[model samples]
Target: MKLPTDHSFFSSIRRLLHTYNLPTAYQLLESPPSKEVWKTKLNSAVDQHTVATWQEDIQEKPSLKYINTDALSVGKTHHLYTYVRPNRIDMLTAETKAKLLTGTYTLLANRAVFNQYAVNEPS
Candidate 1:
């Protein structure tokens, strides 16, 4: 599947950056990701409610940023497969980290689409 590069898509990326308070700065990795890898990551982010989990992973290890979407722009969906450097999460203060985490949790929890599609929620 080709990647989407429409306004709605970029809008989501922009929102992701804003919510994380991440800078627009990023560096692409040496190699582009393969289809399987891109699909897995994208599926994890959009389908599995794993964006927060991925962000946590990135925050825990700066190196992981290279594989995450730190450098976003308007273009083919394949751009998402490009490894980009993220903000130095390791440098964030504890309070700041907590706030970011909370923001992500809130966003995921409140997403209407997520609620509509999510299953196995605890009563």
Candidate 2:
């Protein structure tokens, strides 16, 4: 999904950087980069944080010999494909989904609408 260049969006990223104790990254928020650049940086930070936490949690738990690491990798890939990217069938709201199904919503129009909807969507 394209990152929204709205103030609230940047503010949330600033808070996330602070929460992660990533002072260097937090500093970048003071003079934010271009939207594309910022999005890349943010994605990198999030991915690193996710992997770090997951590794830590796994280390704390008992090892499961039957667990297939390859399967776990595939599951993570599936999750990213299903939820992280935009324009997915399941990510659309009911109203939008209906419009799409009825051929009222074109991809071109939906891109703009979906980006706005995604930005304003509640956590």
Candidate 3:
């Protein structure tokens, strides 16, 4: 939801993996699942490296460990970030096309900030 405009390679990869695993914000509100459910879903959707990265970036961070209930409503106005290659545009399903037309999804093309300071900064 509220698709991040950061289109850098690593940021895109992270978003893709997170979306593949986690439920949408709306889904979380409809059925507030436990952390274990989230973890299981994450593990099922990604490789070991991704999972380990999640552990280090999110799970290990005190601020990010708990769900932020306030942010769940963001999905109502914005769809998840989706990247489609130019050549693969024709491969999208009818439903996906409809969503895109309806402005439920965003196609971000902006460059992400990726300086060394940002990468090396401690959380």
Candidate 4:
């Protein structure tokens, strides 16, 4: 009985939402002589963005503090843009913390945010 071996279906499909790392030599790869400099510069910029994002991810806080990295980096970010306050804060006044947490998450998780971060560069 030669059983079919394609068991990893869901895992492969899930990869669509994952971002893959770009190689270091992407800019230097062989290309047509036309627009070489422009292409190289753009590639370098994109790579730099990726590197910054990677650094931010490595430094992400373990606690529930919210940090925004969109302006800071593009590649390394784990799709955590927008307001990310604590789920529940006991130290602060209830009214203030609740107000801070209420529509902030909703505003952050709007349709646009979902489109932007639902897909992420999975490590």
| Top candidate, metric TM-score | 2
Q: Which lDDT tens digits does candidate 3 get at residues 20-43?
A: 766555567799878998777666
Tens-digit per-residue lDDT, 8-37, candidate 4: 554443332233333233333564235776
Weakest 10 consecutive residues of candidate 1 by summed lDDT:
72-81
Q: What would the per-residue lDDT of candidate 2 be over residues 9-117, giving only the tens digit for each residue?
A: 7677767776565555546758768889877766766766776666666667765343344454411544333443455555556446566555677786566676755
Model 1 lDDT per residue over 29-52, tens place: 345567798566555455334456
How does model 3 score by TM-score?
0.24
How displaced is residue 31 in candidate 1, in Å?
A: 4.1
Off by over 4 Å in 4: 1-34, 61-123
lDDT per prediction?
Answer: 0.52, 0.60, 0.56, 0.49
Sort the candidates on TM-score, descending order: 2, 3, 4, 1
Candidate 2 stretches greater than 4 Å from native: 1-15, 21-26, 63-76, 79-123
lDDT of model number 3: 0.56
lDDT, residue 46, model 3? 60
In terms of lDDT, the best-performing candidate is: 2
> After aligning candidate 1 to the native by TM-score, how far in Å is the CA of 85 from where it should be?
46
What is the TM-score of each predicted model, taking all chains together?
0.21, 0.39, 0.24, 0.24
Candidate 3 at residue 88, lDDT? 52
